[model samples]
Structure formats: structure tokens, C-alpha cells
Target chain A: MREKLIEFRNVSFRYGEEEPWVLKDVSFDIYKNEWVAIIGHNGSGKSTIAKLMNGLLFPQEGEIYINGQVVNQDTIWDIRKEVGMVFQNPDNQFVGTTVQDDVAFGMENRGIPRDEMIRRIDESLTAVGMQDYRLTEPHRLSGGQKQRVAIASVLAISPQVLILDEATAMLDPKGRLEIMSTVSNVQDRNELSLITITHDLREVVQAERVIVMNEGVIWDEAKPREIFAKKDRLREIGLDVPFIATLADELNKSGLRISNEPLNHEELLEDLWTLHSKM
Target chain B: MDITFKNVDYIYQENSPFAHKAIENLSFHIPSGSFVAVIGHTGSGKSTLIQHLNGLIRPSNGEVHIGDFRLTNDDKPKNMKELRSRVGVVFQYPEHQLFEETVAKDIAFGPENFGVYKRDIEKRIKEIIPAVGLSEELLERSPFELSGGQMRRVAIAGVLAIKPEILVLDEPTAGLDPRGQKEIMEMFYDLHQKENLTTVLVTHSMEDAVKYADHVIILNKGTKYMEGKPEEVLTQQEALNKVQLDVPEMIEFLYAFEKRFGLPIPFKRQSVKQLADEIQHAMKEAGSHE
Candidate 1:
């Protein structure tokens, strides 16, 4: 779809009228059904950017357009309805004791019919791979499970754009994979656009596009391959290059006659096989 | 059970409607002089488990023992004032636990509380300042004014000041940049090795645990689910997946190699590149065999 789900036009935001702008003049766009990752070190204004999308923190200057509607006082609630947020810190975000109860809290606020709410809750939990623990108390579940429940809560609202702000930071490695897979599937199955703000570079491997932010500005933007090309620069921004990226860089340095095109293991293997067969 | 939990149970807000069981029938141990990493997805009762180690809470049904100190599941029976000196527990966001003005004073808090000599407290402050990778100049500065990573080191140094035999750090590296994460863990590793300290590291990063942990402990639903060396625990992908744990990404690649390429790569290779090199060599040897 050519439709732009969200657009920021020189968006600058501040916490208070007199306070310094938390986000300097910034401009970016999220197309419908696209999975875009916003990455930067802490205090690079990543969280502030995520807050802007949901209208949790409004812009002090410039403008943000969500679903073709300007994000402002008159339309903030509607914009939020279209762009739900899942924040970091599992312990702080939990509103209910039991997993089932926590997932239901969102629907309850919306005044969904009791029966429909029950069905939606089940569907959301299953979407995040957390259906088995619906009856368990959320506080008793592992960090990863709690995060899944948090995602389910956001999904239960059935918004068009899902913003996950470092959602996997508290989760262990396996849990991180589960959440990543769930997000990938959510975008595919539900056709919801995603704006994931995370410092975990491992996550960017699967993103459709990557946006690196620095001092509240888009420092770089490209597809995974192109973005990962500047490995040294990425590290300079306090970001990690992929293991594959490092390997490729090393091969280039070591005078290995490997093709420059292979970006992943599968591609590298095919390249090596072709080289060997030709020899 | 080096630190065993036998039919151990903990119910928060007990005797009221809000009552909840944090952990159930949990049993595990921390053998002396071992670096044990406890990997749980967030609420696997990790904090609840560590609290018992220092007699912070009296278990409702089970008993907790740290060396000679024995604790029944019921009743608060602990000479915890003394236990605090033996076992140092660094909670998450330990910086928030800081109160004193200067870094050195904050570190000296623990040793001072234990009624150690003033000279000994001063001695610990000076020695551990560098161990945590902080300069002596930082000793006089206000901890609140320091950067987050530096503040973290100060907090860790504070914990290190008392020089507890058994040190437990819960997600000591959460919210840090990659370099900060690596640095703090390296400090922990250094301290763990240089001193014969019994260390328990609670973390979500499999890479950190697999790299530094001598032993790995997995807690599931407030119970001691599994305990073994890091290598032994990680090889069981099925069990790890059940509790939502993962081997490092590099290790996962090796596991995939064995399943897909029919490669007979052994596990002794240390780093990712080492494993990749081994794979390269094995593939070459296989080609020669063909």
C-alpha cells in the first residue's frame, strides 16, 4: 500500500514549555504494513520518538501525522486508538495480578461486550504465544512471559500501528527470540505496521528497514544490508554490527576471495560452493 | 543442595485476599566458590530466591541454609546483621539503593555498618575503587552527579566494599549499552576469579551467563528447574526453550550446523569464530573424504 501510516514533519518535542526540546527537529515516515526499527543509544531520543507516535508526549514544535490525521489535542485519543504502545519495564506496566486479568484490563476500559472481550483476549494471548499461561498470575510468570502478556494487551486493542519500546530488554535470549518472532508474525498475520524502538541490535537483523537516530535526528536510513555496510560507523554510534557483518569485514581484510554480495550464512555458503565448483 | 529449597514455598500478602505464592516447592543450591548464573524470564521467582539466601524473608514452608546458618520456612529467624557481611546481594538498579554523598562514603557504608575498623573501611574503599574500574578521583565526587554507567560502577563498588564471600548481582547490566554490559560483567568475572567468592549472577542475557558462569541454574515458576554447568544446560535446547531460555546466537548456529549439515563438530571451541573455523575445517575434511 502506498498509504503513509505515520509522518513527522520537522517534529521537535519538549517536556515543558520552558524546558529544552527533548527531540530536536526530526522527520521520518512509516508506511502502512512496514516493520521499521528505530535504533540509538540511550538518551539518543529513541523513547521520546516512540512517545511521539502514540501522542503520549505531544510535540512542542512541528507536527506528527498518524493515519493521515494530525496528532494534536483534538485527535490524540483517536490517534492513540490507531497506534497502541508497549513500553519497557515489565514490573511497572503490569496493571492486573493474573495474566488473564491484565489482558482484559484494556478491553474493559474500551467497554467491549463481555463475551467479545473474552474471545479477543484469548486471540491476543494466542497471538503472542502466551495462551497457556492465561490463568497464571502475571507477577509469578517469567520476565519474558510478562512481556508477552504486555504485547497481548496492546494487541487486544487491535490498533493499526504497534510501538514496542525496548520490549525485550528484560527478557532472556530465548524470550527475545519469541517476542521477535511474535512481532514478525503479528505484522504478517494481522497486517499491522510496526515501529519497534530497541537498542538490541540482534533484533534489527529481521527488520525491513533500519533508522539510526542521533541527537533526535535520522543519522542513517537504509535496508539491512546497506545499513550494516558501515560497520565501523555503526559501532561508533554505540551500536553493534551483526556477527555476519563482522565476519564479512574480517574476510575482506584477510584477502579471502569471497564475493562481496553474500550478506548471510546461506548466501555465503552458496557463494563458496560456486567458487569451489568453478575452480 | 548447596543452597537447597525442599518443599519451599513463599506466599506474598499472605492471609489476605491479595495473597499470592511467589514460588512453590523450590529447591536449589549454590556450591561454594562457584559462579552460578540463574536465568529466568522475569518473574521466575529469582528475586524471591535470592532474598532467602540472606535471610531477608522467612520462607512459609521450606528452609534456607547458607553454610551453617539454617532457616525454617516459617518465622523470621536470622542473625541477618551478621549474614549481611557474609552474603552481599546487589538488587537491580543498585544505584537507587545508594544514599551517601560521596562514592567512597557510600561504599564504606556496608563495612561501617558491620562495625569494621575505620581503617579497614578506608582500606576497602581505596582497594575496590579500581577493582570495579573506577578511578580514585571518583571517590570524592557525588554519585548522583555521575553518568549512569559510572554510577553503576560506584554502586557495585559499594557492594564490593564489604567484601562478602558470596556475592549476588541481579541483572547488574540491565539498561546499559553493549560496552557497558560487557564491562560490568567483566568486572564481576574478575572479582569472582581473583577472590574465591561464591557468586550468583541473575540475568536475561544468555551470552553473558554462558561466557562467565561456571555453573548455570534455571528457575521455573519459583522452583529450581535445572542446575549444571553452562555447557550442559545449554545443550538441552528443549528444556531451555520450555522455560524460555536461549543459548547464545553463535552457539545456536553451531547447533544448527550439526542438524542441517550433518557436521560432527565438537563443543570445545571457545568463541563464535572458533566454532565457525572448526566448521570450515570439518567441511574441508568431509570434502576430502568424499
Candidate 2:
């Protein structure tokens, strides 16, 4: 059986008594080494969940468990050690002058040894494919390179869970792809659980499971294919289906045989070729 | 207002050791009331080119003509404020520029600065609120109290309050969600048509360029890499890839289909439904030949 790394039980949160609840009775479980994507429109409470996981915010009712321990004021410090977060706006999160120095910031905060910090900084930089830019300053690098450095800093601490809250929203298309591929490569060699909060459906294709949020509630939870199958419903909820799925649906409507849940271009083309040969 | 750039060059910190040319010999003409998309990667001179449109920066070499205002290194229009009032630039993350206590005041800030009459500013505010998809109820509320998307709309409404003849958008939908992105783009397109405004959009999304732009200019390393109609320029996948860009997904799909079926499907800015119909027709024709 798989282990449950994180759990939220009947959690509800709000900033104050008069403020409306941002998360209402939200419950979910994340397993070890799983990649889950949480998607919602702006102000949909998706970012609230990321903060609640790392104890940045506390629930007004019910409880949250991280690594089989309840999150409380006393345990918050220990819980933070297990959960590392990368937020939106690459410029706001960067602290160090150089690439290597940025990766060492988190480790230095925990009073890690000099030799150990050196080893970890090197390992994390190489993992994100940014080893050659160790001496480069933050302003000199492109948006994509800065994000990679942010990812490496998060990895240097070696947290069990990594939550990226709209991390790629500020980046261009090329920068978005670079961060996505870097996260995939890091996951292949480590047992890290990734929670990506985004509104971009293209990034959702990489997740093992998807959780859709609407109006401060958990609207749906399923695999990527199952979630994308309902194209009109997604559109109604202020989300968009991927381009491949939209094209596949158009083909199906036009008396062509294609799967309604094609995740990528190659799959849709393969299905079309099969149908074409039989015709 | 038509925009023309002739042999323009913009250099940062000119005549110093740190001097670097941001735009080199860039020349393009955007006819009055036409929508143009400037496509490029980061640091590719897209921002520098747009700054010239509103007379924000004088070109180091050559000349720029926007309507009757001509800007060169040696001379600038005496009425620079009037030129600015006619060109509206909705920059990336415009919400950050909001500072007024109420939405109504924030929207009125621009027109007030341009010496617009008080009653005219109020009239523009009323017409702009609903046009940018905002309710009248929020006009009295604090701009900081609104959501990110709402703040962006309010900022855009401020730009429109001046009633500019030309609109420049610098990735106006950068941090918005999918639905918000569509709504904002559609709103801009609607305004572009109704007002007969010349639109210049600097964006990285090839999809947006293909959807809304009649002409596209691709920039690479401070130079014009290519310029033509969207269908003619964007279909060159190899050339775009050289600049660290890709064709839109529709064109990419068509290319893959051509490779798999040994058939060519010309892209004429077709919608998905139209493209599907063409694909269906192509498949039947191939089967009959076999």
C-alpha cells in the first residue's frame, strides 16, 4: 500500500470572521512520490491550499496532517522542514547575488555545515541544468534561468513536498517549458511529491492526478484524461481544455474517429491514422 | 494613426563602454487602424520598438512618424503631452500602477492629467466601466480591495478613458487565467474594431498572434527576422524555430498530419471546425486515390 504523505480533513479557512470562507470543508490525500496538479481561476482558493500545506496559514476549523503529524503552532516549524514552496514572481523569491549563493540561502538558514552546503548546492544546480551559471548574477540571467535557480534552491533543502503556486505564470512560453521539464527530471531521480497550482491546462497534462477548485471548494478530483473529457463543463467553470483535446472533439463531431481524451499531438495523430487506414 | 519606423536604432547608454544596441535598423509600417503583433523572445528589442510608438524614447538613428508627430534624435514634438494622450499603452501587470483610493478616480487619473474636462472624464468613466467588463458598483470601492483580474480591468479602463487613437498592449494578459485572458483579449479586439484604433500587441503567444493579428513582425537579437501576414510568416516552422519560437498548435498539428498522410493542408487561418472539415475532405480524397 502507498503511504499518505499529506492529508486535509474537513479543513475550512478565512482571513477573519466577516470575510467569506476561502476554503470550505476541503479534504484530500496526497500519496508518496505522486505528482498532483490543482487548477482554478484567479481567487478560486487554489493558492490558499498551498499556504495551508506549509503552515503559512492555519485552518479555522478541522485539521491538516503532514507526515502523519497534526499541524499546530508548536509543530509548524517541523512541518515547514518537510514542505518547501516556490511562489509566483521569480524576482520576489530570489535573495542571493549569484546562482550558487542563492542555492545556499536555504541551507544556511538551517545552520548546515560548510562542506555539506557546498555538496548540496552543486547537486541541486546540476539537477536543474544550471551548473554552468554558478557565478552569474540574478539580473544577467533570463526569466527561464532565474526560475531554474529558484527550483534548485527549493531542492537544496531536500524537502519531501514541493509546492509551486503559479510559479510559471510570469514566465514566457519558453520559460514555462523549461521549468516543466526541469521538474520532471528532478522527479525521476528523487522521491519528491509535487503539488503544482496553476490555471494553465497544458501543465495539467503532466500530473498524475488533477484537482479542480471552484468557489472555494473541491469541485472534482480525477486523472488528467477524465478531467479533460468534459470540455464544455471546464469552459463553464472558467477553465479551458487543452488544444489537442479541443481538436480531437472537433474531429469526432465531424464524423471522424478519434479519442476524446488525446493528451498530446502524437496520440491524436496515431488515432487518426488508424481510422484513415480502415477507410 | 499610422506608425512608420525608418532605419530606427535604439542604443542603451550610448557612447559609453556599456552601450548596447537594443534595436538595429528596424523599419516597419503599420497602417492606420490595423492590428500588428510584435513577436520575439525576451531581450529581443520588442519593448524598445514599442517605446518609439508613443514618443517615449527618441530613436538614436533615423526617424519615427506617428500621425503628424515626427520624432528624431535631434527633434521631438513640442506638444509631447498631446502625443501621449493619443497613444494608450497597457503594460504588463498594469494593476501594479494603480494607486487611487476608488476605482472611479483611478480610471479618471489619466484623462485628468491630459487636461480633460471634469464632465468629460465622468462621461468616459461611465462608458468605459461596462466596456471593460466591470460593474458600476465597484467604482466607489478601493482599487486595492479588488481581485487581481478586476484590478487589471480597472487599469485598462483608465487607459481607455483618454480615448486614444492608438492602443499598445504589452502582454496585457500575462498573469491572468485562461478565461480572464480570453475575455480581456476579446474586449480589446471589440474596442479595436468599434473605435477604429490602431493596435500593436507585443506578446510571446503565437496563438494570440495568429488569432487576432493581420500582420506579424518577428524580431531576433535586435533585428527584424521576418515580417508578413500571419498565415504566410507563421507557417515557416523552421525559420521561427531558429528564433526560439514555435508555430501555433494548429499549424503544428497540420504539419504532423502532412507527415503522417503525405498530404499538404494549407493553413488559411481556419477555425477548428473548418480545419476538421478540410481534414475530413483530405482523407476521403486520399482513400479514393488509393
Candidate 3:
């Protein structure tokens, strides 16, 4: 049986008493060593969930549990050690001048030994493929590279959960792909649980499960293929299905008997080829 | 106003240790009232090229013509205010520039400075509020109190309030969600048509470039790599691959499907239904031959 790494029970939150609820009775569980993608339109209470996870914001109602331990003011600092978040703006999170110094910043705050900090700085940078630019300043690096450095800093803390809150939103297509692949490799190599809050469907294709949010609620939860199956509804809720999924849906609608929903281009082509050979 | 670049070269911080050539021998023309997209990887001189549109940066060498105004190395446009009023630029993350207490005042700030009468400024705000997809109720709220997406629209509305002939947008939808991205791009498209505004979009999204732009310019290493209609320029895979640029998703899918099935499928920016019908027709023809 898989262990639950994080759990949200009947969680509801609002900015203030007068403000409307940002999250309404939301509940979800992230399994250990699993990759979960949380997607929704902006102002759908996605980023708020990220903050609540790390105790940056406390739940106005309900309970959030990390490894079966309830999170509150007393346990916030302890919970933070287990959850390391890389936010949207890389420049905003970076506190150090050079890449190495930034990666070491988190560890230095916790008063890790000098030799240990140096070791983790090297290891985490290599994991994100940013080892060569350890001495380079943050401004000199590209947006994608700076984000990878941010990821490295998060990794240096050795957190159990890594929350990337739209971390790839500001990057170009190539840069977005770079961060995705790097995170995938790091997740596999390190066995870290990843919660990627994003609107990008391509990133969702790689995740084990997807949680759809809308109107400050958990709209639906399913595997990537299942999520893509609801193409019209997804678009209605302001999210886009992957290009291949849309293509498959189109082909199916055109009287083609596609045996199953194809998640990628190769799968779609395979389905077509099977039909073509039979024809 | 139509814009032209004549062998323009831009060097940042000339004669300093950090000096670098941001653009080199770049030359392109943007016709009046036409929608053009500038695409390239980061630091490929895309930003440097767009900065010349509205006098943000003068060329280090060569000349740029924005309608009647001419900009060169030694001489700058004398009427900088008039030049700015003619060309409105929405820089990346435009919300970062919003500082007014209320949305209406923020939108009015630009036109008010350009000598728009107080009464006209109010009229312009009322007109542009809905154009950027914001309700009239938002005009009274503080810009800081609005959500990030709403703040972005307010900022864009501020620029549109200027009523410029040409609008230059630098990744205006950079950090917005999918729906926000679509709404903003669609709003710009409508403005480009209904208002007959000359729109120049600097973006990283190939999908947006393929969908909206009449002309696409690809920049590489401080130079013009390719310039043509979106259909012609984006279909050539090898050329885009050489510069590490990505083709739009639809084109990439068509390419991969053709390679796998050995079927030649023409690429065009078509609706999903149209593409599905074409593929079905092709498949039926192949089946009958078999």
C-alpha cells in the first residue's frame, strides 16, 4: 500500500472574514513518490493551496495533515522543512548573487555546516543540469536556467515534497521543456513527491494524476487520459486539452473508429495505422 | 504608422566592459495596420528590435523610420512625446507598471499626459474598460486590490486608452492562464481589426503567432533569420530546427503523423473539424486504392 504524503481534509480558506472563500471544502491526497499536477484558471485558488501546504497560510477551516501530523502554528516550521516551494517568479525567490550562493541560501538559513552546504550545492546543481553555471549571477542566466537554479535550491533542502507553483509560466517553449525534463529526471532519481500547479497541459501529460480546479472548488480528479477525455468541458472551464488528445478526439468524431484514446502523437498514429492496415 | 528598419544595429552600453551587440544589421518592414509577430529564443535580439518601434532605444548605427519620423545614431526624434503618443508599447508583465490608486485613474494617466482633455479621458476609460474585458465596477477599485489577471487587463487598458496608431506588445500574455491568454489575445485581435491598429506582437507562443499574425519574423543571434507569412515560414521544419525554434503544435503533429504513416498531409491553420475531414478523405482514398 502507498503511504499518503500529504492530505487535505475538508479544507476551506478565505483571505479575510469579509472576503469570499477562495477554496471551498477542498480535499485531496498526494501519495508518496507520486507526481500530481493541479491545474485551473487563474484566481481559482490554486496558488492559495500551495501556500497553505507549506504553512505560508493557515486553513481558516478544516485540517491539513503532513505525514499524519496536523499542521498548525507550532508545527509550521517543521512542516516547512518537509515542503520546499519554487514559486512563479524565479527572480523574486533568488536571494543570493551567484547560482551556488542561491542554492546554498536555504541550507545556510537552517545553519547547515559549511562542508555539507558545499556538498549539497554541487549535487543539486548537477541534478538540475546547472552545475556549470554555479559561479554565474542570476541575471546573466536565462529565465529557464534561473528557474532550474531555483529548483536546485529547493532540492538542496532535501524536502519530501516539491511544489512548483506555475514555475514554468514565464518561460519560453524551449525553456519550459527544459524545466519539465529536468524535474522529471530529478523526481525519478530522488524519489521526491512533486505537486506542479500549472495551466500547461503538456506538463499534465507526464503526471500520474491530475486534479482539476474551478470556481474555487475541486472540479474533478482523474488520470491524464481521463482528464483529456473531457475536452469540451475542459475548455469550458478555461483549460486546454493537449494537442494530441484534441487531434484524437477530432479523428474519432470524423467516423474513424479509434480503438482507444491516444495520449500522445505516437499513440494516435498507431491507432490510425491499425485501422489503415485493416482497411 | 508603418515602420522600417534600415541596417539597424543596437549595441548596449557602447565602449564599456559589459557592452554587447544586441542587434546586428537587422532590417525589416512592418506595414501600417498590419499584424506582425516577432519570434525567437530569449536573447536573440527580439526585445532589442521591438524597442526601436517607439524610441525606447535608438539604433547604434543605421536608421529607423516610424512613418514621417526618422531615428538614427546621432539624431533622435525631436517630438518624442508625439512619437510616443503614436506608438503604445505593452511591455512584458505590464501589471508591474500599474501604480495608481484606482483603475480609472491608471488608465487615464497616459492619455491625460498626452493632452487628452479631462472629459475625453473619462470617455476613453469608459470605452476601453470593456474592450480589455473589465467591468465598469472594476474602474473604482484599487488596481492593487484586483487579481493578477485583472491587474494585467487594467494595465493593457491603460495603454489602449492612449489611442495610438500602432500597438507593440511584448509577451502581453506571458504569465496568464489559458483562458486569460485567449481573452487577451482575442481582445488584441479585435482591436487590430475594428480600430485598424497596426499591431506588432513579440511572443514565444508559436500557436499565437500562427493564429493571429499576417507576417512572422524570426530573429536569431541579433539578425533576421526568416520573415514571411506564418503559413510559409512555420511549415519549413528544417529551417526552424536549425535555429532551435519550435513549430506550432498542430504543424508538429502533422509532421510526426506524416512520418509515421507515410502520408503527405498539407499543413494549414485550420479548425479541428476541417483537419479531421481532410484526414478522413485521405484515408478513404487510400482504402479504396487498396
Candidate 4:
């Protein structure tokens, strides 16, 4: 059986009494070594889940358990050690002048010994493919490079669950791909429970499972392919699907007999090739 | 107004130790009332180029011409107020600049500063609120009270209240969701058409560049890398890839399909249904010939 890494039970949260609940009775469990994408439109409470997980905010009505430990203030510190979150703005998260210093900042805060911190800084930067840029200043790096450094800093803590809260939202397409591939590499090398909170469908395509958030509630939970197949409903909730999925849906509507719902370009091409061969 | 940059260069902190050449020898002509999209990776000088469109920053080496107005290396335009009224710029994350008590006051800020009549400012606010797809009920609320997407619309409305002949947008839809992005882009395109404005869009989205722009310009490392019609410039995938750029998804799909099937499928900005029809026809013809 897969181990449960984090669980939110009967969670309901709001910023203040005047404000409406942002997340209402939301319950979900993240399993060990699995990738889950939390997707929603803005103001949809997708990001609240990330904050709740790391103990930045406690739910008003419910409890969040990290590895079976209740996430109250006393246990919050321990929960943070296991859950390292990379937030949306790359510029805001950067706390060091140089790349190496930035990677070491987290460990320094935790009072890790200098020798071990130095070792981890090297290992984590190498994992993100940013080893060559170790001495570069934060301002000199690209948005994608800075985000990777943020990932490296998180990895320095050796967390079991790494939460990327719209980490690639501010990056260009090339940068987005870099973060996605870097995350894939880190997951390959470590036993990580990765939760990516984003509205980006391209990122969602890579996730093993998707959690759809709409209007402060969990709308649906399914595999990425299953989520993409609900293209119209996804759009109705103010989200989009990848190009291939949309194209497949369009072709199917136009009387093209596609046997399966293709998720990406390669699969779509293969389906087209099969149709062409039969013709 | 038509814009021309003749061998322009801009150096930030030119004489100091922190001196950096932000743009170099950048020369381009934007004809009056044309929609031009400028695209490049971060630090590729896209921001520096747009600053020249208005008189935000004067060129360090050469001349920038906005119709009859000229901005040269040694001289600042005396009529900067007049030039600014004609060119409205919506900067990235424009909502952050909003500080007014009400949306009406915020949108009216631009025109009021330009000496528009008080009555006329109110009229412009009424007209612009709808143009940006925000209901008039939002006009009384503080901009800070609005959602992120709504605040962005309010900021765009502020720029539009000036009724600029030249609309220069620096990624107006940067942080919006998909529906919000589509809505904002469509609003800008409609404004571009109805007002006959010369629009300059600096963005990171190749998809938006292909869908809306008549012409596209690519900047690389403080220099003009390429400029042409959108279809022509975007289909050159290898060249774009060299600069760490991507073609629009439609064009990319076609390119990949051609390579995989050994069929020469020309790239076109068409709906998926149309593409499907063309692919089916191609398959029929190829099968019959075989």
C-alpha cells in the first residue's frame, strides 16, 4: 500500500469573518511518490491548500495531518521540515545575492552544520541542472534559472513533499519547460510527493492525477487523461486543455473515428496515422 | 502615429560602474495603425524597446521618430505631455499602480491629468468601463477591493480613457487565467480595430503574437534579431528555436506531424476542425496514389 504523506480532513478556511470561505470542507490525501496537480481559476482556493499544508495558515474548521501528525502550532515546525514549498513569484522568494548563498539560506535558517550545508548546496544545485550557475547573482539569472534555484533550496532541506505553488506562472515558455523537466528529474532521483498548484494545462498533462478546484470546492479528481477528456466542462470552469486534446475533440466531432482520447502530440499523431493507414 | 527607430541604442547608467547597454542598434519602422507584436526571452531588451515607443526613455545613440515628434540622444522632447497623451502605455502588472479610492477616479486619472474636461472624464470612464468588460457597478468600488483580473481590466481602462492613437501594451494579460486572457486579448483587438490605433504589444506568448499581430518583431540580446509578417517569421521554427523561442502551438503541431509522417503539411493559423479536414484530405490523396 502507498503511504499517505499529507491529508486534509473537513477543511474549511477564510481570511476573515466578513470574507466567504475560500476552501469549503475540502478533503484530500496525497500519497507517497506521486505527482498531483491542483488546478483552478484565480480565487478558486487552489493555493490555500498549499499554504495549509506547510502550516502557513490553519484551517478554521478542520485539521491537516502531515505523515499522521496533526498540524497545530507545536507540530508545525516539524511539518515544515518535511514539506518545502516554492511559491509563485521567483523574485520574491530569492533571499540571497548569489546562487550558492540562496541554496544555503534554508539550511542556514534550520541551523544545519556548515559542512553538511556545503555538501547539500552542491548536490541540490546539481540536481536542478544549475550547478554551472552556482556563483551567479540572482539578478543575472533568467526567471527559469531562478525558479530552479528555488527548487534547489527546497531540496537542500530534503523534504518528502515539495509543493510548487504556481512556480512557473511568471516564467516564459522555455522557463516553464525547464521547471517541469527539473521537477521530473528530481522526482526520478528522490522519493518525493510533488503537488503542483497551477492553472496551466501543459503542467497538468504531466501529473499522474489532477485535482480540479472550482469556486472554493473540489470539483473533480481524476487522472490527467480523464480530466482532459472533459474539455468543455474544464473550459466552463475557466481552465483549458492541451492543444492535442482539443484537436482530438474537434476531429472526433468532425466525424473522424478516433478510438482513444489522445493526451499529447505523439499520441494524437499515432491516432491520425492509424486512421490514415485504414483509409 | 507611425514610429521609426533609426539605429537607436539605450544604455542604463551610462557613465557609472553599473552601466549596461539595454538595447543596441535597434532600428524598426511601425507604420501607422498596424498591430505589431514584440517577443523575446527575458533580458532580451523587449522592455527597453517599448520604452522608446513613448518618451519614457530617450535613446542614447540615435533618433526615435513618432510621426512629427523627434526624440534624439541629446534632447528631451519639450512637448512630453502632448506626446504621452497620444501614446497610452499599460505596463506589466498595471494594477499595482492603482492607488485611487474608486475605479472611476482611477480610470479618470490619465485623462484628468491631460487636461480633459471633468464632464468628459466622466463620459470616458462610462464608455471605457464597458469596453474593458467591467460592469459600471464596479466603478464605485476601490480598485484594491477588486479581484486581480478585475483590477487588471480597471488598469487597462485607465489607459483607454486617454483615447490614445498609439496603444502600447507590455503583456496586458500576463497573469490572468485562460478565459481572462482571451477576454483581454479580444478587447485589445477590438479596440485596435474600432479606434484605428497603432498597437505595439510586447509579450512572451507566441500564440498571442500569431493570433492577433499583423507583424512580429524578435529581439535578442539588445538587438533586432528578426522582423516580418507573423506567418513568415513564426514558421521558421529552427530560427526561433535557436533564440530559445517557440512557434505557436498550431504551427508546432504541423511541423511535428510533417516530420513524423514524412508528409509536407504547410503551417496555417486555422481551427482544429479545418486542420483535421485538410489532414483527412491529404490522407485520402496519399492512399489513392499508393
Off by over 4 Å in 2: none
Alpha carbon deviation, residue A237, candidate 4 (Å): 1.0
TM of each candidate vs. truth: 0.81, 0.98, 0.98, 0.98
The per-residue C-alpha lDDT of model 1 at residue A28 equals 86
Candidate 4's iRMSD: 1.4
TM-score of chain B of each: 0.94, 0.99, 0.98, 0.98
Local accuracy of candidate 4 as per-residue lDDT tens digits, B139-224:
89999999999999999899999999999999888778888899999999999999999999999888899999999999999999
- Taking the tens digit of each residue's C-alpha lDDT, what string does model 3 give over B149-267? 99999999999999999999999998888888999999999999999999999999899999999999999999999999999999888999898887888888788877876777887
lDDT per residue (tens digit) for residues A121-209 in model 4: 99999999999998999999989999999999999999999999999988988899999999999998998999999877888988999
What tens-digit string does per-residue lDDT give for candidate 2 at B80-112? 999999999998899999999999999999999
| Candidate 3 clashes between residue pairs 3 or more apart in a chain or in different chains | none
lDDT of 3 by residue, A1-279 (tens): 999999999999999999999999999999999999999998898999999998999989999999888899999888988999998887788899899999988998899999999999999999999999989988999989999999999999999999999999888888899999999999999969999999888899889999999988999999998888999999999998888888787788899888678888788888888998888
Model 1, position A49, has a per-residue lDDT of 89
True contacts kept of 2: 0.73
Which residue ranges in model 3 land beyond 4 Å of their true spot?
Answer: none
Give the number of colliding residue pairs in candidate 3.
0
Model 1, A269: alpha-carbon shift in Å?
5.0
lDDT of 4: 0.91
Query: CAPRI verdict on model 4?
Result: medium
